[model samples]
Target: MDRQEKRAFVAFLAEVFASTSIVIVTENKGLTVADVTELRRRIRATGSTYKVAKNRLVSRALEGTQFDGIAPLLKGPTALSWGADPAAMAKVLVEFAKTNENLVVLGGALGSQTLDASGVKALAELPSLDELRAKLVGMLNTPATRIAGAVQAPAGQLARVFGAYSKSEAA
Candidate 1:
């Protein structure tokens, strides 16, 4: 690669490391072009990215970043999957790997903490930010709904009682 190309790649890697919440490393040795394209599609659907860069460049880019510890995992035929939501990226990688044996998850770095393959899988099981937010909103709404029903109960009972009393008088 030309010097200009190298510089551009380093800059791109730096941007990715800066913007992402987690960086997942994988060894994509024998994955076909179609398989990679499919994986990229799935990752893009979740607003993340899948990239394969030189290990040296990755290590250089990782230096001084929160994902510095992941440099060790960059030694082999590494591909990186990363995004704002760690769970989403992990989920995609794990789900894709389930069907594609060529994609082997090595390890990853979340902030300063490095994680093994199992750790990445565990992360995949966690709810995403949007799911967690939806749960929170549901919890918040439940009490309000119950409160409204409780507040209306007395009036409803009063109306029912008046209706019954009127029917009895007519009888």
Candidate 2:
């Protein structure tokens, strides 16, 4: 890569680092092209991207950034998988690793917090952003639903009483 290309790539990495909420680094040494492509596809499906960047450039981009903690793991043939949702990306990467041993999970970063391989795995087990949001909505709607049910109960009881009274009079 030329100087201009390198600079552009560094700039791009910097922007990606800033936008992403989490980044999981991996050592993809023996992964075949097809394996890497499939991994990238799965990661992209979760609204994340996987990039194999030069460690030097990656280190340079991470300078003065929140992801600086991950600099130590930037050694070797590293591929970065990052996204706005930490759990989602971690889930994808961990699942992929389970099937492909070639992709070694080095470690990662969630903002300023550094995570080891197991930490990243733990993150993968958490409920996703969408799932959490749905649960919160369900929790919020529960009270309103109970309120509606309570409001209708008295009328239902009154109608049942009137029906019984009418039957007794007819008899």
Candidate 3:
């Protein structure tokens, strides 16, 4: 690549490292083009993306970024899976690594905090932001649903009682 292209790519990587909540570094060595394509598809489905950059370029991108701590993990056929959702990339990489032996999980960064392989696994275990929000909404709605159900029950029973009494009188 030319100098201008390199500068643009470095800037783009820096932007990615800055804006994203989480980025998982991994080695995609010997992974077939089809496998990488599949991984990208899966990542996009979750509103995330996978990128492979040269180690030197990624290291340069990390300078002055919160992801500088992750520079060590940027070696050897490194590809990054990143997204707005902090949990998504770690979750996807950890799961993919489980099935694909060639895709080695390197440490990553969630903002300034550097995560080891085990930490990445732990991150995968945490509920995603969306999942937590859904859970909170469900929790908040439960009481209202129960209140509606309870309020309707007495009226339903009263109607049933009146219907039974009327039928008996007619009989």
Candidate 4:
């Protein structure tokens, strides 16, 4: 590519490295367009972006960034999966990798924290952002639900009793 294109990509990658909560680097060698399109669609569905970029530009982008730890892994047919929600992206990549044999995950970076293969695996296994939010909402709603049930119990019993009395009077 031209120098201007490279510079623009570097700038873009630098911004991504800065803003993203997590970045997963992969070697997507020999992956077909169909596979890539599927992966792209999945990433876009989750408000994420997947890019196959040149190593030089990626290396330049990693300069002085928090995710500089991942710079070295940019070699080969490197594709980056990045988004605002790191957990979601990781989960999606891991799940996608289960079926797509061509995509090999090298490692990743979660902010300043560097993740090895095992770290990435662990992250993949953890509940996603949406799952965590759902769990939290369930936890918060539980007490309210219980309280409503408790409050309605006596009224329900009283209504049942009155209904039975009226039925007996008719008998």
Candidate 5:
């Protein structure tokens, strides 16, 4: 790329780093275009993004950003995937790396915290934001349902008792 284009890319990456909550770096040593395309598709499905970039340009983008700690992990042919949800991004990378040996999970940064490959894997194991929200909603709804059932049980029993009394009185 020319100087202007490189500068523009660096600016764009810097802005992305500033906005995103998670950034995962991977070494795509021998991944084919099809593999990358598939990876991108899966990541995009989760509202994340994956991009292959020059280490030097990435380093420039890391300057003064919260992700600067990941600069050391940017050696060789590396790509970055980032998103608002930390678990979602890590899950995609870790799962893809499991299927594709060529894609190595180097490391990443969650906000200002730098994570090793193992840390990234651990993050992946955690439930995603949407999953956690769903679980929370379920938990909340369960108590309300139980409360409704408890409230109705006494009324139902009372109705049954009144019906039994009326039948006995008629007899």
Candidate 6:
């Protein structure tokens, strides 16, 4: 890229680093275009983005940012994947690395915290934000449902009793 283009790209990276919650660094050594395309598709499906940038450019982007801790992890042929949901992003990288050996999980930063590869894997194992929200909604709804059932049971029994009494009186 030309000087102007490189500067613009660095500026863009800086903006991204400022806004993202998590940034995962990976060594995409020998991944084919198809593999990368598929990886990008999977990541994008979860509202995340994957980028391959020069180490120098990425380091420039990391300057004065909370993600600067990850600069050391940006060695050879590295790529970055980031998103608002840490677990979801980590999960995608870890799972993709498992399937494709060429894609190596180096490490990452979650906000101001730097994570090792194992830490990234652990993050991946946690339930995603959406999953956690769904679980919370289920937990909340269950009690209300049980309460409604409990409240209706007595009324239903009373109606049955009144019906039995009327039939006996008629008899």
Worst 10 residues of 5 by lDDT: 83-92
Which stretches in model 5 have alpha-carbon errors above 4 Å? none
* TM-scores for every candidate against the unseen true structure: 0.96, 0.95, 0.93, 0.91, 0.96, 0.96
lDDT per residue (tens digit) for residues 15-71 in model 2: 999888899999999999999989988888889999999999999999999999999
Model 3, 1-171: lDDT tens digits are 999999999999888877887878888999998888878887887798899988898889889988788887876789887887767767777888888888888878887899998989999898988899999999999999999999999999999999999999999
**Better by lDDT, candidate 6 or 3:** 6
| lDDT of candidates 1 onward, in order | 0.91, 0.94, 0.86, 0.87, 0.96, 0.96
The CA-based lDDT of model 3 is what?
0.86
Alpha carbon lDDT at 94, candidate 3:
82
Candidate 6 per-residue lDDT over residues 9-36, each given as its tens digit:
9999999999989999999999999999
Candidate 5, residue 78: Cα displacement in angstroms equals 0.5
Candidate 6 Cα misplacement greater than 4 A, ranges = none
Alpha-carbon runs more than 4 Å astray in model 3? none
lDDT for position 5 in model 6: 99
Tell me the deviation in Å of residue 47 in model 1. Answer: 1.1
- Report the C-alpha lDDT of model 5 over 1-28, residue by residue, as the tens digit: 9999999999999999999988999999
What TM-score does prediction 3 earn?
A: 0.93
- Pairs in steric clash, model 3: none
TM-score of 4: 0.91
Candidate 1 pairs with clashing backbones: none
Better of 2 and 4 by lDDT: 2
lDDT of predicted model 5: 0.96
